[model samples]
Target chain A: MTRPGFTGSALDRADPIRQDPAALAAARADAGARLLRMDGIDPVVGPDGLLDWGGLDEAPPGAFLALLGLIGGSPRFVALSGIPGGAQRSPLMMELLDAWPPEEAATYAAARSLIDWHARHPFCARCGAETAPIRGGWARSCPRCRTEHFPRVDPVVIMLAEHRGRVLVGRQASWKPGRYSALAGFVEPGESVEEAVARELHEEAGILATDIRYLASQPWPFPSQLMIACVARTANDALTIDRHELDHAMWVDRAGVEAALAKLPGAPFDPPPAYAIAHSLFRMWLDG
Target chain B: MTRPGFTGSALDRADPIRQDPAALAAARADAGARLLRMDGIDPVVGPDGLLDWGGLDEAPPGAFLALLGLIGGSPRFVALSGIPGGAQRSPLMMELLDAWPPEEAATYAAARSLIDWHARHPFCARCGAETAPIRGGWARSCPRCRTEHFPRVDPVVIMLAEHRGRVLVGRQASWKPGRYSALAGFVEPGESVEEAVARELHEEAGILATDIRYLASQPWPFPSQLMIACVARTANDALTIDRHELDHAMWVDRAGVEAALAKLPGAPFDPPPAYAIAHSLFRMWLDG
Candidate 1:
């Protein structure tokens, strides 16, 4: 059983300590407090090709801080809201996961999501007032309206939509040639996981999804998304591509799927990379 | 098998209509367009004791409109952001679920969640710009910053933690007397569902949970929330209640759970209502 990426984090995420301002301040002042340096939502790699770390002293004056729980016995932190979206962040995040250890990669993912949210949400959505970061950068509060804001992890359903024997896969024009992945869309405001699955299937492709089953989930922290992996049976396998969403979509049989999964050349289409939950979804589909 | 409340709706959620302004305008101008009336976040019951609905003519001038998808090919809309949060919304929402049929109830839940989110988000969190509702109230756009906003459905983990032969249950101070349910907490930005369950169980009641499993999900619309249901095995049964969060917590045995679930007199605790995911969680636990 291969574990999905960004799942098993070692941090305790000290929620009680977040509630106590004094305790948080004490943790920041502790001798073992460490900082994860970043470059515009991307983790900065040290000379050793690992996540760059320094003392709390490295955190700039008045810089917004994100407490990444406690790593071992040391309080790990990330300073944010300084370098906001100046680089290509999505690709960099995926690249980071490959370079670091599993727990360290998850820690970095947490830091990136927290920092990105804090950077983007300097003002309140309710009152348009400049909000202050609270709960160790886990939440924000507006001075004018006193409305508290927490970082949002948008839920998305990535489906391996099966019809008869073939499974549906889609390709975006921007992706590398011949590369395709599972159909996915964000879970809407007022929908259950199953409802979102059905809706997205209808919206993205001209198919109706039923018998939706939740397989697994992964934390995708490219600006914070929770990818809920599922398998759904589709009645109409006929591909009516919603061009606004996907460049192309088709029903691929088991041979093509197996070839793509094995990374063989001339396999009709390339599978999603290993770090992606779509890759895991494919594995789950094949295994089941 | 009993289905979770708010899990199914009859609406199409007309994403394509939302993208086409002309089509949406045509729908609004259509003689068949229906408006679901609301009274300060609560649905106004008609003379017949059903959801009060009127024509597009009844939508107040300058009222923010939420397109509650297309109900049986006629666009069902809700006028909102006018009467926002003056009543006891949570209880009213629960009451609405009991009164309406499953599909109608689900539609009401969608309207409530969408309208409430639209009401709260008058401005942008990214740039504090006063945003305009677009996509028929499905999304908002900030003209000043060119940023788009979508209604948020906060994810929460509701867990039934098993230890030995008993399950842990907790109660908040504001809840009705003698009522208890599974421990739940918000899934923070950087956490997975399993991680959230473990963190919440540890934070709310000093317990270590293992074998965490995802069972089901439900849309809980008081404001807006997606409750992810789970059951976990805990090594420790000794309860340590977080006084700041819960009034009390205890490990209740199968006999106690069965009695409470049966609503027997003097059962020691009242179970959560069927509308709540916690109620379903306990039922699943018992069946398993």
Candidate 2:
């Protein structure tokens, strides 16, 4: 089973948008600081092996560093978390935007999420006009169309399907080899999270679930998603991966997963990082 | 036992100052258009008891009606849902900003709630300077001190507490006489809805509840609130009204409530209007 809060390296990428309006203002007003559009920057690793946010007044300009939010009463900035010019680069980045206190991660998550949204939705969708950041950068207003735009977050359902003392997980070929995790997918336009969980499992792995119950929720800002976690019972289990979406699908016994977790890379299955909700589901099941 | 969606009028004063760009554009471009600021107009109730949006041809030289969202397929315009100078006169007129359908009311509610927020929060709380609408009306940005303001939705836990076959209901002095319904209260900052339900029950009725289960949720915009519906088991049946918040509290057996539902305004306990969630909660319990 997955463990809660185990962060994976696969999901973290550096976002390139200047999210902190306050910092943007500071940078803009400072005679020594330079202002550059996101497109003008090149993809290159700095001396630190991380996407650089440039140096102090005396240092060289690296990746553009912009302050985003404050976590635990301290300023937090987004880093280019991925390798520069790497083939597997994902545009989205997941950083611990908040300070290390951790108990109040939800607050930092909310702040980081809105900042990320601002970076992406810079124009009015209805009129396709350039929008200006207003309301302290929490929203944007278009001069041409006057349309106001807010950040958007999609909801996805992640569930642990349990029966016969075992929980089910599936693997996508895109993930690291032998890494299997809970069944998850986005909630559709007209469906509830509960319905989405059942539908996703049915479509991806041919599993029918019943007695669904909600457990917890996590703010997953990998391009703005809210993961609704749930627990369900499997009425039937058969292997069927929609080859178009997944490379393989199966029902692994809890003991089998335990063995895999113990064996590391040698096993045919590994759970997602502990920070993910999937890890939490697996941990809850194993603890029980 | 508390029913589904019943409580007196929700707190309805909002603090947004931003306008929807698209709606503003449509208003400006309409053939018979005029625009008037909230401070410039004197609202009048017609003989028919409805505030009229003067026809396109008759609209004063620069007058345009403000529209919010779509109802059904047509745009729903804001023309005053209440009368001027009435005892229940709205402190603020509800603006029709978009044509949001009822099926997507939750999403529409979010949009409406935030847009309405911008309409109200025009000044920085920290510094009294005028703020501009930002992030498409999701927030307000202060130019003087650079502060961002976000829309706030108060979370309330509405619960159905069951004791054997009977359900609990309560009445508030401000409500219509004989109008009794579910128990609910606002969830404070830093508290979960589950904890809110448990605390509200104990405070208002002197009862303890266990077995809390989430049932459903609704977006109520009397002034932007997210109502979380839940079911709980009563640990004790003693009745005590915390008059600080409610007028009366009591436990009515299922049969009595069923009988009361059939005769509104006649019995000591009255069911809420059919459109309310409280009525649905009562129905669910009765059917169960």
Candidate 3:
């Protein structure tokens, strides 16, 4: 299977040094230290189709800085940034993903999640006290209550529910016309990945899931999400679709899936983009 | 593989009803509405080794209440309760797991997670506004900024790194004497499960991971964590233990693991309790 987009980052997170103030200070002072350049949370891609970087002096004064990682023993830093954007994937992000190396995309993703988490959560949830970066910006500590906060990666389950050699898929009304993808929803607290898959299937399409299996995972930086991909079997073909959540829901056979995946004329629907884990699911399904 | 602890719940989450206020009111008013009885965050076990329950009238007035699920056409509800206890697993919880039906334990785990989240996050992190439960207590909405908050399920990677005939394991200083378990850490934002497994193994034991494979997942509701169990291979047996996080690290062969599992008198170390996902990871490792 192809390595999913926004993965396979080569940077060593160097967590051991994150705890040592002296080490972190030395890293910042190193002549080779590079700071990732960004436009808010968006990546600033270089001519070489990788993340743009500059000396540590380029960081905005007083902005929080987090160690992205180390490459060739040079410290990589990103200034923490956030404006609390809506949970909508943008066309610019798609373009950025296509224009950068997968590893650089992943490195940017890590830095973005950490920085945004710090910016959006200036106060602690436990005691409503102001927070400051700690652990080299991997975590935050509340000064008043001393409550610690870690950057959260919300888990979302995207899956193909199959029955009788057909796969279940759905598309929202607002999406590009003729674009359909596997159904997905956030894995709520207190639910396992399998349970989330089953719950989401049942709630959105009235499909009872069985034999839920983990396929692969991808880190999506639309404000930091971990997409857990899976495939499951459905007991029957019946779907009680929730129209409010989906514009249409269908079970497409392998031939229809192939046509869609190939982007042929008169295809049932357009496949999800290559960067989406759902596309990988369809590819795996085709192979099976 | 055996079902991990805190899974296989039987209740219908009834998400559709969660969105309708009239339906929520109807559920609460139903004569069959059942309130889970709890002594603080701990379970109140019935004589039949199931969760004890009472009528809706037992709920604390004006306390946040969540619809847990529907069981046999009856409404099951849990009052959102929290006192922010330290993250310590009590001995009583172990006894409850040993005594109760697994399904009931799962149900209780779900309720505890939801209720505790509501209690801990009364103030919104986005704007520090006082938040109120919406969507049948499944989500909190900040009145000031209208930013919605869903309960977070922190994903943690627990893995065994094998080299030659032995598997890597570690023990925390505060654990019961001679008790060892898989090295685990929270999956930070912007990393896949595979990345987390590799990062955690390297940080905790200096073992570089390869062929990281997901075994299974378990929802642990001690403040709501999703334990993703995995196994990976290490290239060599060379050891570099970080004493700050782990008191001791070792590579034990199948014989050593078997003896530990059996509670033999001369076991190298005590196996983690049956309720921990680490225990299930070891069991799966042995089967291979």
TM-score of chain B, per candidate?
0.94, 0.66, 0.96
Q: Residue A262's C-alpha lDDT in candidate 2?
A: 69
Question: Where in model 1 is the C-alpha error above 4 Å?
Answer: A85-87, A90-93, B85-87, B90-93
Q: Top model by DockQ, which number?
A: 1
Highest TM-score against the true fold, candidate? 3
Residue range B144-227, candidate 1, lDDT tens digits:
989999889888889999988899999999999998999999887767788889989988998999999988888888878888
lDDT of 3 by residue, A1-288 (tens): 888877888888998778999999999899999998887777776777778899888887887779887998899998875545443456676788766667777887787777667767777776666778898898888887787888878889999999999999899999998889999998877778999999999888998999999999988877788899999999988999998789999999999999998999988999888777898899999998
iRMSD of all candidate structures: 1.0, 11.5, 1.1
- Winner of 1 and 2 under TM-score: 1
lDDT of 2 at A146: 69
Docking class of 1: medium
TM-score of 1: 0.96
- Each prediction's TM-score against the native? 0.96, 0.47, 0.97
Error of 3 at A195 (Å): 1.3
Better of 1 and 2 by DockQ: 1
What are the per-residue Cα lDDT tens digits for candidate 2 across A136-235?
Answer: 3445677975666545555567998887877777778788877888888765322344555777777777788888787755556453555667888989
